[model samples]
Target: MPHDWKEIQAGDEEVFKKVFDSYYQPLCLYANKILNDIDLAQDLVSECFINFWEKRTSIEIRTSFKNYLLLSVRNISLMHLRKSGEKLGNSQFVIQELEYVEDYVNELEEEKQIVRVHQAINKLPEQRRKILQLAVYNNLSYKEIATFLGISVNTVKTQMGRAYRFLKEELKDDQLTLFLLFGSNFE
Candidate 1:
Protein backbone atom coordinates (compact mmCIF):
# COMPACT_ATOMS: atom_id res chain seq x y z
CA MET A 1 0.00 0.00 0.00
CA PRO A 2 2.97 2.27 0.65
CA HIS A 3 3.84 3.96 -2.64
CA ASP A 4 7.20 5.35 -1.59
CA TRP A 5 8.89 5.93 1.76
CA LYS A 6 10.75 8.84 0.23
CA GLU A 7 7.38 10.55 0.10
CA ILE A 8 7.16 10.20 3.89
CA GLN A 9 10.62 11.76 4.10
CA ALA A 10 9.18 14.63 2.10
CA GLY A 11 6.45 15.12 4.75
CA ASP A 12 3.59 13.20 3.22
CA GLU A 13 1.09 12.06 5.88
CA GLU A 14 -0.93 10.05 3.36
CA VAL A 15 2.11 8.05 2.38
CA PHE A 16 2.92 7.40 6.04
CA LYS A 17 -0.64 6.29 6.69
CA LYS A 18 -0.61 3.91 3.76
CA VAL A 19 2.70 2.43 4.90
CA PHE A 20 1.39 1.93 8.44
CA ASP A 21 -1.81 0.32 7.24
CA SER A 22 0.04 -2.04 4.94
CA TYR A 23 2.74 -3.14 7.39
CA TYR A 24 1.04 -3.11 10.78
CA GLN A 25 -0.84 -6.42 10.61
CA PRO A 26 1.94 -8.49 9.13
CA LEU A 27 4.52 -7.01 11.49
CA CYS A 28 2.28 -7.73 14.44
CA LEU A 29 1.95 -11.33 13.34
CA TYR A 30 5.72 -11.65 13.05
CA ALA A 31 6.22 -10.20 16.52
CA ASN A 32 3.62 -12.55 17.92
CA LYS A 33 5.69 -15.50 16.81
CA ILE A 34 8.48 -14.35 19.12
CA LEU A 35 6.34 -12.99 21.97
CA ASN A 36 3.49 -15.53 21.76
CA ASP A 37 0.95 -12.89 22.80
CA ILE A 38 -0.99 -11.15 20.10
CA ASP A 39 -1.88 -8.18 22.26
CA LEU A 40 1.70 -7.65 23.31
CA ALA A 41 2.87 -8.08 19.74
CA GLN A 42 0.41 -5.43 18.60
CA ASP A 43 1.56 -3.07 21.33
CA LEU A 44 5.22 -3.54 20.47
CA VAL A 45 4.69 -3.07 16.75
CA SER A 46 2.61 0.02 17.43
CA GLU A 47 5.27 1.44 19.69
CA CYS A 48 7.93 0.76 17.10
CA PHE A 49 5.95 2.60 14.45
CA ILE A 50 5.29 5.45 16.82
CA ASN A 51 9.00 5.80 17.41
CA PHE A 52 9.62 5.52 13.70
CA TRP A 53 7.24 8.37 13.07
CA GLU A 54 8.81 10.52 15.76
CA LYS A 55 12.22 10.08 14.14
CA ARG A 56 11.04 10.08 10.54
CA THR A 57 12.83 13.32 9.77
CA SER A 58 16.20 12.08 11.06
CA ILE A 59 16.33 8.33 10.88
CA GLU A 60 18.89 7.01 8.44
CA ILE A 61 18.00 3.44 7.46
CA ARG A 62 21.07 1.75 6.03
CA THR A 63 18.98 -1.02 4.51
CA SER A 64 15.56 -1.01 2.87
CA PHE A 65 12.82 0.71 4.84
CA LYS A 66 10.96 -2.58 5.19
CA ASN A 67 14.02 -4.28 6.64
CA TYR A 68 14.54 -1.43 9.07
CA LEU A 69 10.99 -1.76 10.33
CA LEU A 70 11.24 -5.55 10.66
CA LEU A 71 14.56 -5.33 12.45
CA SER A 72 13.08 -2.83 14.88
CA VAL A 73 10.26 -5.24 15.66
CA ARG A 74 12.67 -8.16 16.08
CA ASN A 75 14.96 -6.24 18.42
CA ILE A 76 12.03 -5.06 20.51
CA SER A 77 10.68 -8.63 20.75
CA LEU A 78 14.05 -9.96 21.87
CA MET A 79 14.25 -7.19 24.43
CA HIS A 80 10.88 -8.27 25.77
CA LEU A 81 12.10 -11.85 25.99
CA ARG A 82 15.19 -10.81 27.93
CA LYS A 83 13.14 -8.57 30.19
CA SER A 84 10.87 -11.50 31.02
CA GLY A 85 13.97 -13.43 32.06
CA GLU A 86 13.01 -16.46 30.02
CA LYS A 87 15.46 -19.35 29.89
CA LEU A 88 16.01 -18.99 26.18
CA GLY A 89 17.77 -22.30 25.60
CA ASN A 90 15.12 -24.29 27.43
CA SER A 91 13.05 -26.29 24.97
CA GLN A 92 9.88 -24.97 26.56
CA PHE A 93 10.94 -21.36 25.98
CA VAL A 94 12.09 -21.82 22.42
CA ILE A 95 9.93 -20.52 19.59
CA GLN A 96 6.88 -22.73 18.98
CA GLU A 97 5.58 -21.24 15.72
CA LEU A 98 6.53 -23.96 13.23
CA GLU A 99 7.06 -21.41 10.47
CA TYR A 100 9.47 -19.49 12.67
CA VAL A 101 11.50 -22.55 13.66
CA GLU A 102 14.29 -21.47 11.34
CA ASP A 103 14.45 -18.13 13.13
CA TYR A 104 14.93 -19.86 16.46
CA VAL A 105 17.35 -22.41 15.04
CA ASN A 106 19.44 -19.57 13.67
CA GLU A 107 19.63 -17.84 17.06
CA LEU A 108 23.04 -16.70 18.20
CA GLU A 109 23.26 -19.27 20.98
CA GLU A 110 22.33 -22.15 18.70
CA GLU A 111 24.70 -20.84 16.02
CA LYS A 112 27.52 -20.76 18.53
CA GLN A 113 26.78 -24.31 19.59
CA ILE A 114 26.79 -25.41 15.96
CA VAL A 115 30.10 -23.67 15.38
CA ARG A 116 31.65 -25.28 18.45
CA VAL A 117 30.51 -28.73 17.37
CA HIS A 118 31.93 -28.17 13.90
CA GLN A 119 35.24 -27.03 15.36
CA ALA A 120 35.46 -30.07 17.56
CA ILE A 121 34.67 -32.39 14.71
CA ASN A 122 37.23 -30.64 12.54
CA LYS A 123 39.85 -31.13 15.21
CA LEU A 124 39.29 -34.85 15.11
CA PRO A 125 41.80 -37.02 13.28
CA GLU A 126 40.86 -37.05 9.59
CA GLN A 127 39.89 -40.71 9.37
CA ARG A 128 37.79 -40.57 12.54
CA ARG A 129 36.09 -37.39 11.41
CA LYS A 130 35.25 -38.95 8.06
CA ILE A 131 33.97 -42.08 9.74
CA LEU A 132 31.89 -40.09 12.19
CA GLN A 133 30.44 -38.01 9.35
CA LEU A 134 29.59 -41.19 7.47
CA ALA A 135 27.96 -42.76 10.49
CA VAL A 136 26.08 -39.76 11.79
CA TYR A 137 25.54 -37.18 9.05
CA ASN A 138 25.43 -39.58 6.12
CA ASN A 139 23.48 -42.21 8.10
CA LEU A 140 25.73 -45.04 7.06
CA SER A 141 25.97 -48.27 9.05
CA TYR A 142 29.32 -49.35 10.41
CA LYS A 143 29.48 -52.21 7.88
CA GLU A 144 28.63 -49.82 5.06
CA ILE A 145 31.27 -47.32 6.14
CA ALA A 146 33.84 -50.09 6.49
CA THR A 147 33.14 -51.33 3.01
CA PHE A 148 33.16 -47.84 1.50
CA LEU A 149 36.37 -46.84 3.27
CA GLY A 150 38.01 -50.21 2.67
CA ILE A 151 38.47 -50.78 6.40
CA SER A 152 37.41 -53.66 8.59
CA VAL A 153 34.08 -53.39 10.42
CA ASN A 154 36.01 -53.76 13.68
CA THR A 155 38.14 -50.71 12.80
CA VAL A 156 35.03 -48.68 11.98
CA LYS A 157 33.51 -49.66 15.29
CA THR A 158 36.62 -48.70 17.25
CA GLN A 159 37.02 -45.35 15.47
CA MET A 160 33.32 -44.54 15.95
CA GLY A 161 33.64 -45.30 19.67
CA ARG A 162 36.64 -43.02 19.96
CA ALA A 163 34.85 -40.27 18.05
CA TYR A 164 31.78 -40.52 20.30
CA ARG A 165 33.91 -40.40 23.42
CA PHE A 166 35.72 -37.32 22.15
CA LEU A 167 32.49 -35.60 21.20
CA LYS A 168 30.87 -36.44 24.52
CA GLU A 169 33.82 -35.00 26.38
CA GLU A 170 33.77 -31.89 24.23
CA LEU A 171 30.03 -31.39 24.57
CA LYS A 172 29.46 -32.67 28.08
CA ASP A 173 27.90 -29.49 29.35
CA ASP A 174 25.66 -28.81 26.33
CA GLN A 175 22.53 -30.86 26.82
CA LEU A 176 21.09 -30.31 23.33
CA THR A 177 24.46 -30.61 21.62
CA LEU A 178 23.65 -33.66 19.54
CA PHE A 179 20.15 -32.56 18.69
CA LEU A 180 21.47 -29.20 17.52
CA LEU A 181 24.42 -30.75 15.74
CA PHE A 182 22.77 -33.55 13.79
CA GLY A 183 19.32 -32.04 13.23
CA SER A 184 18.48 -32.03 9.52
CA ASN A 185 16.03 -29.20 10.02
CA PHE A 186 18.83 -26.98 11.24
CA GLU A 187 20.82 -27.63 8.08
Candidate 2:
Protein backbone atom coordinates (compact mmCIF):
# COMPACT_ATOMS: atom_id res chain seq x y z
CA MET A 1 0.00 0.00 0.00
CA PRO A 2 1.15 3.54 -0.74
CA HIS A 3 1.43 4.71 2.85
CA ASP A 4 2.44 8.26 2.00
CA TRP A 5 -0.91 9.76 1.18
CA LYS A 6 1.25 12.88 1.26
CA GLU A 7 3.03 11.88 -1.95
CA ILE A 8 -0.36 11.22 -3.54
CA GLN A 9 -1.48 14.56 -2.19
CA ALA A 10 1.48 16.18 -3.93
CA GLY A 11 0.18 14.78 -7.27
CA ASP A 12 2.52 11.86 -7.72
CA GLU A 13 1.37 10.28 -11.00
CA GLU A 14 2.15 6.72 -9.91
CA VAL A 15 -0.07 6.99 -6.85
CA PHE A 16 -2.84 8.49 -8.96
CA LYS A 17 -2.48 5.70 -11.50
CA LYS A 18 -2.77 3.13 -8.76
CA VAL A 19 -5.80 4.76 -7.31
CA PHE A 20 -7.43 5.29 -10.72
CA ASP A 21 -6.84 1.74 -11.83
CA SER A 22 -8.21 0.36 -8.58
CA TYR A 23 -11.33 2.51 -8.52
CA TYR A 24 -12.27 3.32 -12.11
CA GLN A 25 -14.53 0.41 -13.04
CA PRO A 26 -16.32 0.15 -9.72
CA LEU A 27 -16.86 3.88 -9.69
CA CYS A 28 -18.30 3.78 -13.18
CA LEU A 29 -20.67 1.00 -12.19
CA TYR A 30 -21.75 2.94 -9.14
CA ALA A 31 -22.30 6.11 -11.14
CA ASN A 32 -24.21 4.26 -13.83
CA LYS A 33 -26.81 3.45 -11.23
CA ILE A 34 -27.56 7.13 -10.89
CA LEU A 35 -26.81 8.56 -14.35
CA ASN A 36 -28.19 5.62 -16.37
CA ASP A 37 -25.96 6.48 -19.32
CA ILE A 38 -22.79 4.45 -19.48
CA ASP A 39 -20.78 7.15 -21.19
CA LEU A 40 -22.00 9.82 -18.78
CA ALA A 41 -21.34 7.53 -15.85
CA GLN A 42 -17.78 6.97 -17.05
CA ASP A 43 -17.30 10.67 -17.58
CA LEU A 44 -18.59 11.51 -14.09
CA VAL A 45 -16.32 8.90 -12.53
CA SER A 46 -13.30 10.25 -14.40
CA GLU A 47 -14.16 13.79 -13.33
CA CYS A 48 -14.48 12.65 -9.71
CA PHE A 49 -11.02 11.08 -9.80
CA ILE A 50 -9.52 14.18 -11.38
CA ASN A 51 -11.19 16.33 -8.73
CA PHE A 52 -10.00 14.01 -5.96
CA TRP A 53 -6.43 14.19 -7.20
CA GLU A 54 -6.65 17.94 -7.59
CA LYS A 55 -7.90 18.36 -4.04
CA ARG A 56 -5.90 15.52 -2.52
CA THR A 57 -3.92 17.74 -0.15
CA SER A 58 -6.99 18.69 1.83
CA ILE A 59 -8.76 15.33 1.56
CA GLU A 60 -9.30 13.43 4.79
CA ILE A 61 -10.35 9.80 4.44
CA ARG A 62 -11.93 8.21 7.49
CA THR A 63 -13.73 5.49 5.57
CA SER A 64 -12.51 2.54 3.56
CA PHE A 65 -11.33 3.13 0.01
CA LYS A 66 -14.42 1.52 -1.51
CA ASN A 67 -16.79 3.66 0.49
CA TYR A 68 -14.96 6.85 -0.40
CA LEU A 69 -14.84 5.97 -4.09
CA LEU A 70 -18.55 5.07 -4.15
CA LEU A 71 -19.51 8.30 -2.40
CA SER A 72 -17.52 10.33 -4.87
CA VAL A 73 -19.08 8.51 -7.80
CA ARG A 74 -22.58 8.97 -6.39
CA ASN A 75 -22.16 12.69 -5.85
CA ILE A 76 -20.70 13.29 -9.30
CA SER A 77 -23.38 11.20 -10.95
CA LEU A 78 -26.14 13.06 -9.16
CA MET A 79 -24.69 16.39 -10.20
CA HIS A 80 -24.58 15.28 -13.83
CA LEU A 81 -28.15 14.02 -13.74
CA ARG A 82 -29.33 17.25 -12.15
CA LYS A 83 -27.59 19.33 -14.78
CA SER A 84 -29.07 17.21 -17.59
CA GLY A 85 -32.61 17.53 -16.17
CA GLU A 86 -32.82 13.87 -15.29
CA LYS A 87 -34.10 12.40 -12.05
CA LEU A 88 -32.64 9.31 -10.45
CA GLY A 89 -34.69 6.12 -10.54
CA ASN A 90 -34.35 2.45 -11.39
CA SER A 91 -31.12 2.18 -13.32
CA GLN A 92 -32.49 -0.26 -15.86
CA PHE A 93 -35.57 1.85 -16.60
CA VAL A 94 -33.55 5.03 -16.94
CA ILE A 95 -31.08 3.33 -19.24
CA GLN A 96 -33.93 2.01 -21.38
CA GLU A 97 -35.48 5.47 -21.68
CA LEU A 98 -32.11 6.97 -22.61
CA GLU A 99 -31.55 4.33 -25.26
CA TYR A 100 -35.02 4.87 -26.67
CA VAL A 101 -34.45 8.61 -26.89
CA GLU A 102 -31.12 8.09 -28.58
CA ASP A 103 -32.66 5.69 -31.05
CA TYR A 104 -35.51 8.06 -31.74
CA VAL A 105 -33.04 10.79 -32.61
CA ASN A 106 -31.17 8.42 -34.86
CA GLU A 107 -34.23 8.34 -37.15
CA LEU A 108 -33.99 10.18 -40.47
CA GLU A 109 -35.88 13.39 -39.75
CA GLU A 110 -34.06 14.11 -36.54
CA GLU A 111 -30.70 14.39 -38.29
CA LYS A 112 -31.96 17.07 -40.67
CA GLN A 113 -33.66 18.85 -37.79
CA ILE A 114 -30.40 18.99 -35.84
CA VAL A 115 -28.49 20.25 -38.86
CA ARG A 116 -31.01 23.00 -39.56
CA VAL A 117 -30.92 24.11 -35.93
CA HIS A 118 -27.13 24.29 -35.95
CA GLN A 119 -27.14 26.19 -39.21
CA ALA A 120 -29.61 28.72 -37.81
CA ILE A 121 -27.46 29.20 -34.74
CA ASN A 122 -24.40 29.60 -36.96
CA LYS A 123 -26.14 32.30 -38.89
CA LEU A 124 -26.47 34.43 -35.75
CA PRO A 125 -24.19 37.45 -35.39
CA GLU A 126 -20.93 36.83 -33.56
CA GLN A 127 -21.97 38.92 -30.57
CA ARG A 128 -25.33 37.21 -30.29
CA ARG A 129 -23.67 33.81 -30.63
CA LYS A 130 -21.24 34.67 -27.86
CA ILE A 131 -24.04 35.77 -25.58
CA LEU A 132 -26.06 32.63 -26.31
CA GLN A 133 -23.06 30.39 -25.77
CA LEU A 134 -22.25 32.04 -22.47
CA ALA A 135 -25.83 31.81 -21.29
CA VAL A 136 -26.56 28.29 -22.57
CA TYR A 137 -23.27 26.45 -22.43
CA ASN A 138 -21.76 28.12 -19.40
CA ASN A 139 -25.14 28.42 -17.66
CA LEU A 140 -24.58 32.06 -16.82
CA SER A 141 -27.45 34.25 -15.77
CA TYR A 142 -28.35 37.37 -17.73
CA LYS A 143 -26.73 39.54 -15.07
CA GLU A 144 -23.56 37.48 -15.04
CA ILE A 145 -23.33 37.62 -18.83
CA ALA A 146 -23.92 41.36 -18.80
CA THR A 147 -21.19 41.85 -16.19
CA PHE A 148 -18.77 39.62 -18.10
CA LEU A 149 -19.34 41.45 -21.37
CA GLY A 150 -19.63 44.89 -19.77
CA ILE A 151 -23.15 45.24 -21.05
CA SER A 152 -26.41 46.05 -19.30
CA VAL A 153 -28.92 43.36 -18.32
CA ASN A 154 -31.41 44.80 -20.80
CA THR A 155 -28.87 44.43 -23.59
CA VAL A 156 -28.37 40.78 -22.72
CA LYS A 157 -32.10 40.22 -22.73
CA THR A 158 -32.45 42.02 -26.05
CA GLN A 159 -29.69 39.98 -27.64
CA MET A 160 -31.28 36.76 -26.44
CA GLY A 161 -34.62 37.90 -27.82
CA ARG A 162 -33.04 38.70 -31.16
CA ALA A 163 -31.24 35.38 -31.24
CA TYR A 164 -34.46 33.54 -30.56
CA ARG A 165 -36.27 35.50 -33.27
CA PHE A 166 -33.57 34.67 -35.81
CA LEU A 167 -33.66 31.03 -34.87
CA LYS A 168 -37.44 30.95 -35.07
CA GLU A 169 -37.36 32.48 -38.53
CA GLU A 170 -34.53 30.40 -39.91
CA LEU A 171 -35.68 27.10 -38.48
CA LYS A 172 -39.08 26.80 -40.09
CA ASP A 173 -39.59 23.27 -38.90
CA ASP A 174 -41.56 23.22 -35.65
CA GLN A 175 -39.42 20.56 -34.00
CA LEU A 176 -36.18 22.36 -34.75
CA THR A 177 -37.55 25.71 -33.62
CA LEU A 178 -38.82 24.21 -30.39
CA PHE A 179 -35.45 22.57 -29.79
CA LEU A 180 -33.58 25.81 -30.36
CA LEU A 181 -35.79 27.65 -27.90
CA PHE A 182 -35.96 25.04 -25.15
CA GLY A 183 -32.34 23.94 -25.48
CA SER A 184 -31.11 27.53 -25.21
CA ASN A 185 -32.48 27.81 -21.71
CA PHE A 186 -30.36 25.76 -19.32
CA GLU A 187 -32.78 26.16 -16.44
For each candidate, what is the lDDT? 0.77, 0.71
Q: Candidate 2: misplaced stretches above 4 Å?
A: 1-4, 90-187
| Model 2 Cα lDDT, one tens digit per residue, 21-85 | 85576566656656668898888888888888888888888864545666677667767777888
Could you tell me every candidate's TM-score relative to the true structure?
0.46, 0.44
Encode model 1's per-residue lDDT on 55-75: one tens digit a residue: 888988887677687778877
Candidate 1, residue 187: how far the Cα is off, in Å: 44
Worst 10 residues of 1 by lDDT: 90-99
Candidate 1 clashes: the total is 0
- Among the numbered candidates, top TM-score falls to 1
